[model samples]
Target: MSCGYLLQMDERPTLDDIRRAPKVLLHDHLDGGLRPATIVDLARENGYEGLPTTDPDSLGAWFAEMSNSGSLERYLETFSHTVGVMQTTEALTRVAYECAEDLAKDGVVYAEVRYAPELHTAEGLSLDQVVEAVLEGFAQGGRDFGIRVGALVTAMRHQARSMEIAELAVRYRDAGVVGFDIAGAEAGYPPTRHLDAFEYLQRENAHFTIHAGEGFGLPSIWQAIQWCGADRLGHGVRIIDDIEAGDPPVLGRLAAYVRDKRIPLEMCPTSNIQTGAAKSIAEHPIGLLRDLGFRVTVNTDNRLMSGTSLSEEFAKLVEAFGYGWDELQWFTVNAMKSAFVSFPERLELINGVIKPGFAQLKWRGARPVA
Candidate 1:
């Protein structure tokens, strides 16, 4: 009996294609992607209390259920549980280290994991201590797992601590912090609310990616780019609204600017559908945006919440859009090119790690027949 999977059986890629592919991740949320078993272990160690279930399987289902409600408020509630357990230095270190290990296992060669330091301060640890512990964890994880990891310090959009988080990111830039970000609901709180922090990052010559256009629309993306000077966009999927589709598409001012300027959009297909940003993975606008020359990269916004990984996200795209090795390679290169790392560093990652991986895949077997 046929399982009726989306891709043609003959057209499906080999395991070698999946295992050997190079990947880059830019839009993951550290608080929303914890392994269920790790959460249980951490909770037990900390005695911080309150889990819906202690059993790992039950807890896993609880997270998927809670996050699937499609209300941003309900979705965000799940993070409270993860963040609550990650209060102490030891807990923080363990979670960060496990995050690296998980990503490495899923074939993510490079990643920029993000979390809000303000969330960890509830246990009375200073923001600086939180940064230091997480950095140490990622450093150790990288050495142990052979994956390159960096942290993106996040500021909650609904809160008034962007300036403080901005300072914290700058303070830890040399230690493993690579960039800054603003996340959370975009409907009521606008990007301009945190203009001072963005301005501060600018003066310090720091980089940032804004969470815009996922649940909201084009204006949020416009302000994040034009007003706040974001280096990249998180879930800028809704920018499709500004472009009229045709044989040759026509772009509005904002869409045209985004494409012409080659701004990188971190598009997470499954999370976009779960969060009600897009209707379906098959209908996502990434292909259109990519065809139009905008720099688009695939990502798993919240791996646990979305039940996905970088490899899974790529597999879904291959099924939905018939993307083969070449397309996947281009997207990975796009992510590396758009990463917040310094020029020479980004070049080295692409040339030294990413391109070589893809080159090996090309020589491994016969190319999949179209």
Candidate 2:
């Protein structure tokens, strides 16, 4: 006789299983994820006096506080404290090393951590020195934990250093720096403001992503892709606005173009909610996009600020969308595919690591009960 559950598919990975499953991250912020204890230690060492608290747990809660005003300025003010402490090479390297370690322990097989080189130059470190320090830490951490990590050099969109930062990214392309990005308020300062930098990167065949459709609207996303030639979009949850909701949703020209072109959308549910981009995980556009076959990828945009990790992000989607192992694998594969890594390298990871990892989890879940 057949077993009672043999006909059923294994679904809803337990929290433990989710944590154990291999994950890929492409939008994590380095300064955004420092452990609260690390912040205290770094602040003490650096003589930085701006911390709201000295205790780890309190600092964690403090950092996680969502601004009541919903002002982008207020949202960005939190980074000032983080960037304040991360002025020296030691602080930057320590923060980066712990980043890789934490992600690896969370079952992240690969991650592209990003930061602005200009932000860390306050302690008199050159842009090159800052990049080197971070690369060193990621290398050491990756070697120690058996995880692969890459860097994305980000420029503040509202600043004038994008051209200079683009040059810095190109100079370190052979190093661990895998791509370039422009992040800041997307309202007035558009990606086209840095058109020269984008054009240079395009000439060099370099990769880049733009922060759009999160703070602004469809116009920002249009400029990021059509004008600036962004390879991917950062926190592109706002693209859903272009879709008319229905039993069979209709995609506007921009939405259809994004889907037809398979442009990757780095959707951060918790972060979106924190910033008022989405009301909740269940109401997030990721569900609709995923259902529509958009190349949607999950990410923890700012882990500490959002109080999330790749595993936790996936678990949220799992609960909200009833995602099974297959859905998790799809998201993971989408991220790995959209990574700035070379084609061959991405293929190796998809076949050698992510696929096998999910296969094992699926297998374990599908087994009959004793």
Candidate 3:
């Protein structure tokens, strides 16, 4: 059944209902989603002594607080500890496995988790070793958790290893790696700086998404899409700057192009707020972009940092924008469509998993509570 636009008066997805529906995640970070207790355990096991707090509760709160400092640069610094402990093969595999388990528990049927290999090579392991350990963990996690998790080998935009990482991503494409990405501070480290990696992926028919228009502005986005030819825009919230609000809300040339081509905007509401990308969940560009028919999909950029899951993200939107089952389902379908997977696989998940799951929720919602 196709997704309906109508919102039944009593049909908005509660936090409980949202948790039961199938979902797809296109933008998420591996290091950014570790369980706080796991971090403490890894630090102890690895003999790495850099955690701000040994207590798991304080460490979890520390991540959320540090990430909420309202500066993207400072927010990114929180990764040092996570990346520090993740240097060992065992540490990397455990984190990846638990990531799959956690997402499955939250009802995420599919997710593409991206991580930088160079970040995990601090301990003398090769980049291939890092990727292999992560892939193995996710493979085991998927079997145990009944969820599908794909890896997107990421290259840090601030660093110079993008070409090598792009090659690595292609090498492991068939072995659970789905795509490539450039993630980091989007300001000084423009996507154009790594044009070689993006061009190389393009020439080889590989897929990639660029971190653009998040910490920077339109020039970053233009460079990613027009120059490097990114397949999707990671946190393209700044595209809202190009539109003039009015009766029809006139879109500028760049905005028009993005909308016309259906470029997927991987908007992470809580993370955006934490990074000062938006003021709050209620005033996020996602609401405007969704209303304007842009292909906007919701995501939990960093589950631990944001102290949220996919269900919480959707629930926040429901409280902020009064979203119902139809809106939630539309976002799920949009994410499945924007996924780096093959068309047939995306279609199967949309039809066989997402739609049926939401249909059941809506049917139950339209009836009185038992």
Question: lDDT of all predictions, in order shown?
Answer: 0.88, 0.90, 0.92
Query: Number of the top candidate by lDDT?
Result: 3
Clashes of 3: 0
Tell me how many clashing residue pairs each candidate has.
0, 0, 0
Model 1 C-alpha lDDT per residue in residues 43-105, reported as the tens digit of each score: 898886899899999999988888787666678778878998989999889889999999988
In model 1, residue pairs whose N, Cα or C atoms come closer than 3 Å (at least 3 residues apart or on different chains), thus clashing, are none
Poorest 10 consecutive residues by lDDT, candidate 1: 1-10
Query: Where does candidate 2 stray beyond 4 Å?
Result: 1-11, 67-71
lDDT, model 2, position 359 = 87
Candidates 1 and 3 compared by lDDT, better number: 3
Error of 1 at 38 (Å): 1.1
**For model 2, how does the per-residue alpha-carbon lDDT over 1-370 read when each residue is reduced to its tens digit?**
5654331453578788999998999999998898999999999998999799999999889877854235556667788888999999899899999999999999999999999999999879999999999999999999999889999999998899998889988899898999999997778998999999999999999999999999899999999999998899998888999999998999999999999999999888888887778888899999999999999999998899888899999999999998898899999999999999999999999999999999888777775754
Query: What TM-score goes with each of the models?
Result: 0.94, 0.97, 0.97
Tell me the deviation in Å of residue 85 in model 3. 0.6
Report how far residue 3 has shifted in candidate 2, in Å: 8.0
Whose TM-score is higher: candidate 1's or candidate 3's? 3
For 199-307, candidate 3 gives per-residue lDDT tens digits of 8999999999988899999999999999999889999999999999999899999999999999999999999999999999999999999999999999999998999
